[model samples]
Target chain A: AQSVTQPDARVTVSEGASLQLRCKYSYSGTPYLFWYVQYPRQGLQLLLKYYSGDPVVQGVNGFEAEFSKSNSSFHLRKASVHWSDSAVYFCVLSALTNSAGNKLTFGIGTRVLVRP
Target chain B: GPKVLQIPSHQIIDMGQMVTLNCDPVSNHLYFYWYKQILGQQMEFLVNFYNGKVMEKSKLFKDQFSVERPDGSYFTLKIQPTALEDSAVYFCASSLYGGTYAEQFFGPGTRLTVL
Candidate 1:
């Protein structure tokens, strides 16, 4: 079955420091990957998505992700962390399990906390 | 940017009761979807609707569950005889199209609590 795994349940980083969140996926075919962030009491926001082209894709808020089919991973990274960046990040795999254009399978989610 | 809006941010109901969750999708969106997120668990897809009909649904979308967009209005997910397990955040999403090249817009989600 197709699935997404965010191994890190929680991460702590100092403001202004760099950050990286790990994600691994299991799928049989070419995968469409996405990163999403959710602030408290807010809806899930798209960060970036990897469809096919370049191995590295840039998202909003200076966030970027590298997709590696060999490793079956699409990890999210940021050059500088901000307190506002502290949120729950989810890695999703887009599969056409249904007719839904976005039949997404999400990871458990990694919660990031930025410390001042 | 386009946005999806879910009605009744919160709802408390007794088990076995019927409930409807409403979603106002992007004005021009053609595909609509519903997902369930249990606390501390990953969000799971429920069903997707288009042209007033259900195009696809996951196993989690039980037989008691139904989705429709009546007269090109709000897309709605109705659960007949709700179960306690149905207590979760139901997120409504829509995209101009389904498949690659379409970015899905999501709502804030409606929290459903069952007693």
Candidate 2:
């Protein structure tokens, strides 16, 4: 079974500070990775996704992530986080096949608190 | 913005009662899914439906849990004999396409509390 691991459970940063939330996955073959953000009382929104080509992918609201195959990591980064960026971020991994069931396995999620 | 909507944002029910959660996916979406999240845990995939049938379901989808889209209009999750462990935020998500690497749009979620 494919699994994801987010080492940090919570992270805090001041407004306008750079932030990076770590994510690691364990899968044998090529993996489809994704980053999602959830605001309080809101649904989870897609931040970005990585299939194969580019190692670095940009997302909305100035969010981006780099896929490292050797490291088995796909970490989310933001140059400057605003107060509104404070939310729960999740890293998910899914198999890259049509017959693999297309189920996403999620990390425990890292809570980001941007203090102004 | 095109978004999914979940009805009864919060539902409080006693144990052994049956509860049905409704979800309206994106108007043009073709794939629908259900996910569950405990207060402080990761969102776990429960099931996925497409073409009027179940595609895949995780182990977390208990025997008491069932999903249906009778008329291809509203996606529903029904839980019979709700258990205390069932108390969590139930999220409904949909994707325009069900192929690999497609991003899913999620609903605001329904908080189910079984007392």
Candidate 3:
């Protein structure tokens, strides 16, 4: 019953605006959390991943994510978003379970639209 | 950045026909995997392969599906008598190893269309 939930189906932000996408995961044990972005017709690109250590991890393209075990959440954030950042973002979860081999359980995804 | 490559990018096949999706994983990686994503749905795990063996597979991996990588070549996912429900974008990923310690890199994916 491991699953990821992205409550926001779509998020819109103006260029140069700060953005935050919410993600919640349900797992009994500590989880490896990741954020991935997919452009149209392209494969997913990993933004960041959190296995342990610092609660906040920085990723490529000025993206960052914070993992909270208490809340079972790993939310993605950006200080400022560009039009190029508009894409579908997925929150993925992995653990040492039968369901998680190289396989990841992904959220439904949140489509970000950067408006000018 | 590591790169995984998938072949064809797109494919169209009739129902009940067999289709094989090819994936070229990153060199020196020991773990390979396949995932399926329908439009507007979350990408789901299909199976994982390591050391030329099927390590684990989800329910989505029907019996009609099989995976192999001969002599460390392309990792192939073959589905026999594909059904319309089988039509989806298939993503191939590879990691240096399996389990929880490795990071998986993904390919561009192959869009399989079953008509």
- Highest DockQ model number: 1
TM-score winner between candidates 1 and 2: 1
Error of 3 at B20 (Å): 0.5
Tell me the deviation in Å of residue B30 in model 2: 1.1
How do the residues A1-116 of candidate 2 rate in per-residue lDDT, one tens digit apiece? 78999999999999999999999999998899999999998888999999888899999999999999999999999999999999999999877544323678899999999999
Q: What share of the true interface contacts does each candidate keep?
A: 0.58, 0.51, 0.63
- Candidate 1 lDDT by residue in tens digits, B66-94: 98898888899899999999999999989
Specify the poorest-scoring 10-residue window by lDDT in model 1 chain A: A95-104
Residues B47-108, candidate 3: write the lDDT tens digits. Answer: 99987789899899999999999999999999998999999999999988677756788898
Identify the candidate with maximal TM-score: 1
Q: List the candidate 1 regions with Cα displacement exceeding 4 Å.
A: A98-100
Interface RMSD of 2: 2.2
Give TM-score values for chain A, per-prediction: 0.96, 0.95, 0.95
Docking class of 3: medium
TM-score of chain A of 1: 0.96
Write candidate 2's Cα lDDT for B1-115 as tens digits: 6789999999999999999999999988888999999998888989988888788888899999999988877899999989999999999999887666778888999999999
For all candidates, the clash counts are 1, 0, 0
Scoring each candidate complex against the real one, what DockQ results?
0.65, 0.58, 0.58
Ranking by TM-score: 1, 3, 2
lDDT of each residue in A1-116, candidate 3, tens digit only: 78999999999999999999999999987798999899887778889999999999999999999999999999999999999999999999987856335568999999999999
Candidate 1 residue-wise lDDT at B19? 99
